[model samples]
Target: MSAASPLRVVCLVPSWTETLIEAGVNVVGRTRYCVHPADRVSTIPVVGGTKDVNWEKVAAQTPDMVVFDQEENTQAMADSCPYPWVATNVTSVQAMPAALEQLAKALNCDALLHMAERYRAALAAPVSRSGRQLPLLSDKHNSSLSVLNDDRPLLYLIWRKPYMTVGTDTFIHSLFTHLGLPLITPGERYPEVDENWLVQHKPVLLCASEPYPFAGKLNAVKDELQLDALLIDGEPLCWYGIRSLRFLESLQSS
Candidate 1:
C-alpha cells in the first residue's frame, strides 16, 4: 500500500478512531460509539459499535481497509468484509505512538508522519522534568516500583463494581515508572478491591478518564471514593495525540 492511495478506512475503536483523525487519515466509516471532539464525528457515517456492527453497510461502502482495536472492537466485524482489514490492541501509553505510526503506514498516509512524531515525542518528553518524585499506579500489578512502599498508591478503576485497581505489567505503570514514581496498585487492568484498601493507601491524586467522563463530578466522586486526593484529567495519562504535548508542558507548572 502506498501513501498516495486514496483509501477508505473504517475505525471501530472510539479512541483509535480519534487517533486516526488526529493523524489525518481519511476515515470513511466509524462505529457509533467512537465519539470525541463532537464536532468532527457528529455527522460522520454511523457504522456499528464494538460488539455489533453493520457489516452489510460496511461492506457496501467498499472500504480500502478496516482498523480494529481488539480491546475496544472485535475481529468478527471485519471478517468477510469486502476489503482488507487490520486489528491492534495497545495496552500502554508508550506503545500508543508506535501503534499510531504502524496504523499510519497501514493506511498509507505518509502525511501523518508529523502527527505521529509529535505523539511519540510527548511519550518521551517526561525524561527531562525535575521532580521530587511522583506516585504511580496502573491497570496492572506486581510492579518494579512495588518495592517502594513509601510512595503514594493510586488505583485506576476501570469498573465500579468489585472496585478494581491497576496492576503491574501495564503501560500506565511503565509511564509512571519513568517519572520516578511507584506503582502500588494490584492486578492487571481493573480488578475488584475495597474502600478499606483505598482509605488505607489514600493516593494523592485520582485520574478520571473517558469511556466514563469524571470531569464534572470530580469532587463528589472523590468524596464518595473515600480517598483524600485531587482528581485530574485522565487524558494526560491516557489519551495519545498532539494535545498530549500540552499535557506534558503543563506537568512542570502543575
Candidate 2:
C-alpha cells in the first residue's frame, strides 16, 4: 500500500503564504498581495488579489488545497473553489496557535505544528533575557499576568484620509486589550477621527506603515496633540502568523 503524496497548495492570504512556505510546503500560487518572503514570492505564480481572485487561474494550477483568510478573501471566492480549500480565520493574536494547528491538521502536515511551536516559544521568551520571561502578552502566565499593570492609553491607526482607527473587531484591538492598554475607538469600525479628537483623548498614537503611509506627515500631530507618536510596523499588529513571531522577537530588543 502507498500513501498519497502531499497536496499542492495555493494561498490567498499573505500570512498563510509565509506559514506554508515556512513549513516547507509546496505553494503553487498566491494572490498578488501575498508579498512576504519578498525574495521568493515573486517567483511564484500569481492567481489574483484577495478581493478579485482568479478562479480559473487557481483551477489551472490543480492545487489540492486553496487557503484563504476569512477576512482578506471574499466569500464569493471561497464558494468558487473547485478543489479542497481551507479558510483561515486567525482574527485575534490569541487565536494564532489554534488557527495554525487547525490548518496543519487539515493538510496533514506536522511541520506546520512545529512552526506553531516556534512561534509560541518565540513569544514566550525575551530574546535577550533568560529566554523564559514573557513580555506584555503571554499565554504562560494566567492569573498574575503583568500586561494589566500599565494603564498607558493608546490609539492605533490603520488608515488615513478621513482617519480610520483600530476597532474592537480587529486583531490590533485584541493585541492592545491583552496588553491591558486603554484603547479608545469611535464606537464603530473604521470610524473617522481627527487631530482635535486626539487632543481631547490625549493618548499615545501609533501610526501604521500600511493602507496609508503616515510618516513625516505626522509632525503636526506630534506638536498639536502634544503626544508621543511612533510609526510602527503594521504586520505584527495586523497579520497573525510567522511575521508576528518575528515581530515579537524584535520587540524584545527594542
Candidate 3:
C-alpha cells in the first residue's frame, strides 16, 4: 500500500529500461532489447523498441509509472501515457547513473540508492592501481594532432545501417577524451562513412560499439582495412545512468 511497494512500471527504451531493471525496480513493461536478467524481463510486457512503441498495448497495462529516454520516445507516446513518466536523455557514459537514481526515486525503490552510490564510487576509482602517474586524454593539447584539431581523433561507430557514430561533444567522446583517446569524427550526428573515408583518416583507434551490435562487424572491418581496433560494449560506454554503477564495477574488475 506504500510507495515503496512495487509500482507497475513500463520502460519503453532499451538503455533506460535496462537501467531500471538493473536497479531492482519492477518493470512490468519494457522494450525488446532489455536482455539482462533475461527471465525476469521476459515475464514483462513488450512495448516494442526505443523508436517504436505500442501505445495501445501499453495503455492496456495501465502502469503506475512509465520510463523512457527523452531522445528515444516520441511526443505522442509521452502524451498518451496515463501515469507519471520518468524520461531520460543519455548521450554519454557519465550521465547514466544519475538517470538510474532518478528512476529509483520516482519508483520509490530503496535498492536504487545503493546502485547510485556504488556507481559513483567506481567511477571515482583511479585508472591505475600501480601508483604510477597516468595521463588523461582530455589534458592533451588540441593543436598537436591533425584531423578534428589534435584532440586525439577517435571514432565511435555505433550502428551500421546508416553508419551512425557519436560526435566529440557526446558522452562517449567525453569518456574517450578522459582516457586520453583522440577524436576523428566531425561534430555532426553519426555521419555515414565508406571504407575509403575510414582508411583515409588513418585513425589511431577505431572504437566500435555493441548497442547497434557492432562486435563482429569491427573484426571484418579491421581485417579489410588492416587497422588495429577493439570492439567495446556500447551500453557501458553510452548508457549514462544507474546501469553505469554496474558498468564501473565491470571496468574495475577487468
Candidate 4:
C-alpha cells in the first residue's frame, strides 16, 4: 500500500488511535478501548479490543493500513491480520520523537510530523533544565495536587486480579524516569505482584485509570498499603505519542 495518504485504517491500540487522529489519517476501525480524543472515534466502528479484534469486521472495512504497537499488541495477532499493517514501538521517552517520525512515514501522514516536533519541544523545556536526570514532574493539568516528595520508589499498577505493575525498561518506566522518580519493581516488563508483595514492599502507588481503571477499584487495599497513593491518568503518562507531549507536566518539587 502506498504510504502516502492511505484511504482508511484500523487502529488496534489506544496510543495508535490517538496518533492516527493527530496525523489526520482516516481511521475507519478502532478497538472498543480506543477512547483518546473521543470526538474523533465516537463514530468509528469497533473491530474489537487490543488483544482480541474481530478480523471479519476489520477486513470488511477494507482499510489501507492497520496500526498496531509492538508493546500493546502481540506478534501472533499481527501475523494473522490480512491488511497491510504498520507496527510502531515507542520504547522510551527519549526515543518517542523518532518513533513518531517513523510512524508518520509508515502511514504517510504528514500531520504527524508536528507531533514529533512537539515531543522534542516538550523535552527541551524544564526537563532539560534539570540536567535530564528524570525528576518526577507534577501533573500540569491537575494543579490542585501538591508535588510528591517521598519517592520511596513509585509503582504503576496497570491491572488488579493477577496484580500487574509497570516494570523496568518500559515506556511507562521511561516516562516516570523522565519525570524524575524511581520505580521499585524490578522485572523485565510488566510484572505481577501479589497483595503480600505490596504489603511487604510498599512503594508510592500510582493507579492507572485504564486497562482496568483503578481509581475506585483498588481503594480498599490501596489504603491498607499505608503508602502515599494517587490516581494517575494513564494516557499522558504511559501512552506514547502526541498526547504525551501535550501533557508534559512541570515538577513542583523534586
The candidate that wins on TM-score is 4
lDDT of 4 by residue, 18-49 (tens): 77787778889999888878888998999998
**Tens-digit per-residue lDDT, 1-254, candidate 2:** 11221779899988789878877778889988888888888889999998888878887888998888788889998887788888978667777778878888777788878767876765566444221222222222122322223354567767766667877777777765654453688765567778787767866566676767665556655565566656656776676787776666665566
Q: Model 3 over residues 87-108: C-alpha lDDT tens digits?
A: 7776665665686577667888
Q: Lowest summed-lDDT stretch of 10 residues in model 2?
A: 130-139
Ordering by lDDT = 4, 2, 3, 1
Please estimate how well model 4 matches the true structure, expressed as its whole-model Cα lDDT. 0.72
Which ranges of candidate 3 are over 4 A from the true structure?
1-5, 128-153, 194-200, 205-209, 212-220, 223-226
By lDDT, the best candidate is 4
Q: How many clashes would you count in candidate 3?
A: 17
Q: Tell me the lDDT of model 2 at 115.
A: 65
With a 3 Å backbone cut-off (N, CA, C), the pairs that clash in candidate 4 are 134-180, 135-179, 135-180, 136-179, 136-180
Q: Which prediction has more favorable lDDT, 1 or 4?
A: 4
- Give lDDT tens digits, candidate 1, residues 124-238: 5645422223323232212244323445555555444445556666555665665655456846665566777667777644444544554455555555775543333455455
* TM-score to true structure, per model: 0.75, 0.80, 0.75, 0.82
Q: What is the lDDT of candidate 2?
A: 0.70
Task: Please give the clash total of every predicted structure, in order.
Answer: 11, 0, 17, 5
